[model samples]
Target: MGDAVGRRPAFLLSVVVIAVFGLLSAVANNYGTLLAIRVVVGMGIGGLTIPFDTMAEYLPQTQRGTALLSLSYFWTFGILLVVLSAYVAQQNFRLLLVLCAIPCILSTLVAAWFVPESPRWLLAKGRSAQALDTLRRAAHVNGHPDAVSLFPLGMKLKAEEPEVKSFAVICSPQWGKLFFFLSIVWAGFGLLYYATIMLVTDIFAQDPAERGEADGEGVDIDYEAITMSVVSEFVGLTVVMFTIDRFGRVASQVFTYFSGGICVLLLCLFASADSTSRNLLVVLAFGSRLFMSTGSCVTWTHTAEVLTTEIRTTGHSFVNSMARVTGVISPFIVQGGLPYRTIGVILFIASILTTIASFCLPETRGIALGTAMSQDSTTAKERTGTPNSQEMSQSPATVSDKEVV
Candidate 1:
């Protein structure tokens, strides 16, 4: 929707929908009603890709990874906030939902007043005048008066306006390999990362008799483990902020996932031992979590980088939707009645899959975000030694102004 219309409109719509659904959830009288409303809220959340792609288009390419990874800070903070809110609003869950809408409302107001549509989108649509206006405003705000030089007027662009709505574009030979590979990586990582979190909680759970005693003694959530989990995620993000550009996206992913897999496997071995120590398990869980979080950061940042601007939002939406679906299934896979040792094997396999997928993907550390799909395909083929597809003949050699936006 953002690709067809504009980023600002889609973003505002998402925010409004989320706020409405959130409020509706607060008033929901039944569990079914709440569950249904939450699904709607998830749809609203799908609009997140619009702003993420827009930010990528607007930011300097060199700093894009750093800026995008920094966005994770807000997500981790939100998780911590939710945990604290659960503690505070134990029996007042409805009130908690209502309070959550406040930030959404405020975000809508701020974005409406401040956020601008993507200039790249405007230019692709042939609204050069509007694109120029947006660029000028950005220049003035950034205090870069010479930013106009970056976009020279009347320069002919060879980019073909992509068919953003057609799923066929992604399925075609030119893009299919990359798209399929990324889909696996996204699903596998989401499954492993979420399953591990759930598995750790289950691992630390007390037996039925112990649970009854703990309840009588007022012991509830595992504060130590939860705190470590949240803190390790932040630590991983911080590490990525410094290492992503230095190591490149592909190398970072390969190393993180491979290392994380080993850590999880070791943790499983320790768990399988006759003498299970809580401290040893916690240490191993923390190590696995740190690398998993690091790998997750790389996955998101690199996905945005490698995709072309025309289909960037659509691609992000698809991959994110896949991740969410896998996340929903992860808990069942890990905590399901399967053998306990099987958990480590599952995650270890997922990590190896991610590592292989990372190798298949091209490096995009210093690549220009504004490059077109056609240009990127050529570069990717050269880097990977893959054959160029004849599908290039299908795209127009010269796109006239009247033929595109």
Candidate 2:
């Protein structure tokens, strides 16, 4: 949808549609009504990345990775806030749903008033005059009036691009291996991260023995464990925010996944010990959550970086859908009739796969989104022309303005 309609409209549509669905969901009368509303809500959710696409267009190359990763802070914080709200409100889910809609409505208003359409998308769609106008406005907003002239209006380039099966393009010779690797990394990490959270709740639940052993002396539920896990995730986000621009997306992701995998193994080993230490278990869980959050942030940033703009929105949707699939599958592994040790083993394997896949990803540190996309498209063409073509060096970043209209 972003490919055809442009990011700004798609983004606004997402927010407005979601807001509408949120309100409807709150008042849904039956399971069937809620289910129908949620399916429509899911379509709106697919456009969630459109804002990121627009954000990338406006940010400096140096700050782009951090900016992308920072989006997760809003997401993670929102999750924590909602959980706390539910706890405080005595689990009034319907009311909470209504409340969430207000923010989406407000955000839609802000975006409609403030956000400009992406110049790159405009260029892609052969709307150069409008693209230049958009760039000038952006430049004025950024206090760089001189930069406006750098993006000439009506710059022409090849106007014809194919729209094959989006998946086929992603899997063609140029991007196939990289796409596969990212899919594995995304799916595996999502599976383990979500599965671990479910497992932790079960692990820390009140023991039936304690409940039966005394009169009104059952052990208090350690809600602190949940708090600690979320805190660790925030800490992880902070770490990524600082180091991602320095160490680059690939290194940070590899370290997070490898270290996280080790933590998972340690958790399993500690569980098998004759004298299991609760403190140690909690510590390991915290570490795992930290790395998982960090890695997840990196994955989101890197996936955006690696794909060309031509296929970016579609690619994001595809990999994100895969991650969501894992989210669905993970509960079965962790919560469905399975031993705790068996669950740990499953997560350990998933984490290891993620670490390995991270190794296959490219470093996209300071590359401009537009330049990266063009470079990859050029490489794809060259490779198709000659199967043995040596990898082409990245061309000097240039803005072409001379092609025929």
Candidate 3:
């Protein structure tokens, strides 16, 4: 929908769907009705990627990595809030659902009123007049009214050829190899991420006798441990935010996946040891959560940057859907009566594979967004340079007039 109609419309539609279905879910009186409503809510949630695509297109290359990575902080904070809500609502699921719906409702208003369509998307569709108008409006709002002069009044982008379906283009030779490696990276991240959570939860939920603890003593410890793990996510985001643009996306992901896998293996070993101290187990679990959180943030940033703008959202959504599939498969492995060590071994191997896949992806650290599918054949080295250097090297007034049109 974003690729066809426009990003703002698709984003607005998504938030509206979530807000409406989320409220309905709170009032659902039957199990089947709630399940149906929640499924619709999931559909809405899937379209949230449109906003990320919009953000990437609007920002300049220099600030793009930091800006995108900063968005992950909201995810960490949202999780913390959900943890609090779960604690407060306890058995009042309806209240919890209402709390969850509030953010979507707020986001809907913001999207409808504040968000504008991407000028790049407008230009890609050969809507040059509208794209110029959008840019002018943005410059006026940013207190740079004269900046609009950088583009000529009669400037026009060459009309793109009759549109091809994004799926067909992504599956073609140009994008296929990049897409395949990205799918593996995303899927491995998803599986390992959820598997870590399940493993930690399982350990805390063990019977008191099995845990070598007094019957009533585990509850407080469980809450404290969970809180620490959640806090570790913030630490992880901080680490990645500082390193993503500096170290580049590929390096960041490679380090996080490999180190995170080791943490997972150590966590499993300590968890299964009867003589291991609880403090040691908690520390290892925190380390695992921290590394996984870092990997997740970098993966999202890298994928958004690497794909060309022509099929950016479609390609991103496809790879993310692969992640969702692995996310679904994670629970069965964690809870399907596999030995703890065995589950850990499987996740470690998956992470190692993902790390290898990360190495195969092109570095997109400082390149301008590729505006055409044909640009995919260019080597990463050829594309890599100071951020926005090609355009910024030109005088502002002549930049878009010469290159963009």
Candidate 4:
């Protein structure tokens, strides 16, 4: 839908869906009602790729990696805020839901009023006038009105617009290889990321000494452990934000996954030895989280960067959907009473496989976003010294525009 219509509309619709459903969830009377509403909320959440795609398209290539990775700070802070809310609400589920909805509502207003449609999407869809106008507006905002003159008044994509569905285009031979490896990376990260967090929470729950008595009330939630986990995420994001653009996406993922897998292996060893050192377990858990957080951030930014603008949102959403599937299954693995070593082996294998898969993907650190699938195919062939006659014939202006933007 984003690729077909425009990124801004899809983004606005997503925010509205989340805000409306979230508020509705606050008033849900029963568990089933709340669950159904949350499903709709999840659908809204799924469309979040639109905004990420929008940001990726609008930003300059030099700053794109750092900017996109920086967005992860909001996510980390959001988690911290949720934890804080949960602590404050103290079982008042209604208040908690309302509090969560507030951000969605505010974001909806901001997106609707402030955010502009992606000029890249406009150009891809044969709306050059709008695309140029958007660029002019952006240039004006940045106090570079003169740069608007550098943008072509009536730009056209060198590659023809794709007629088939976005999915069909990405599934074609040209993009299929990249998509396949990305899917594996996303699914593995999803499974390992959530599973590690849940496993850590379960471990904390098992140690009653960490859980204080609450008289006749419910068991005290371990907010301290949760805070530590969030802190680890922040630390990981801090490191990746500085290094991702410098090292490139593939290298970042490889490092994080390999290091994280080692942490998981150590966790397995500690569990198998039946070590009673709670502090050691906590440290290992934090270490796993730090790496997982960094790896997941790189995976997301890489996915957005690699796909062509024509299929950016669709391709990203597909890979993210695979992640969502594994995310759902993570709870069962962690809470299913499986032995620690078994869970550790599953995560370790996933991390290592993802690490290997990261090598299969091309690095997309500073490359301008490809407007069409053919551009991507041409680039790939160029890398392999097999550029076709048509790709070799593209005009200098068309090529220069890609680099300039």
Give the candidate number with the greatest TM-score. 3
Order the numbered candidates by lDDT, best leading.
4, 3, 1, 2
lDDT of 1: 0.74
Error of 4 at 227 (Å): 0.8
Candidate 3 overall lDDT versus native: 0.77
Give a tens-digit lDDT track for model 4, residues 203-293.
6654434345334455455678768977999999998888775666777888899899889768766855654586787688789889998
- TM-score per prediction, in order, is 0.84, 0.82, 0.86, 0.86
Clashing pairs in 1: 125-405, 126-405
lDDT values for all models: 0.74, 0.72, 0.77, 0.77
**Candidate 3 to truth, TM:** 0.86
| True lDDT of residue 293, candidate 3 | 82
- Model 3: per-residue Cα lDDT over 1-405, one tens digit each: 778888889888889999999989999999999999998987887787888877787677667788888888888888778778767776689999999888779878988988888776776687778877776776767787585575558766443333234587767887888888889999999898988878877776655565566654433327577778888898988878876766677778888899989999988877777888978888988989899888988888878777666687778778887778898899999999988899889989998999998877777665565432233423454333223223322111124433453
lDDT of 4: 0.77
Candidate 2: tens digits of C-alpha lDDT, residues 171-238: 78877887898899889877978877776666666655756755554335566776687788889999
Residue pairs in steric clash, candidate 3?
none
User: Is 1 or 3 the stronger prediction by TM-score?
Assistant: 3
Off by over 4 Å in 1: 99-101, 145-163, 205-208, 211-219, 268-274, 370-405
| Comparing 2 and 3 on lDDT, the stronger one | 3
C-alpha lDDT of residue 349 in model 3: 99
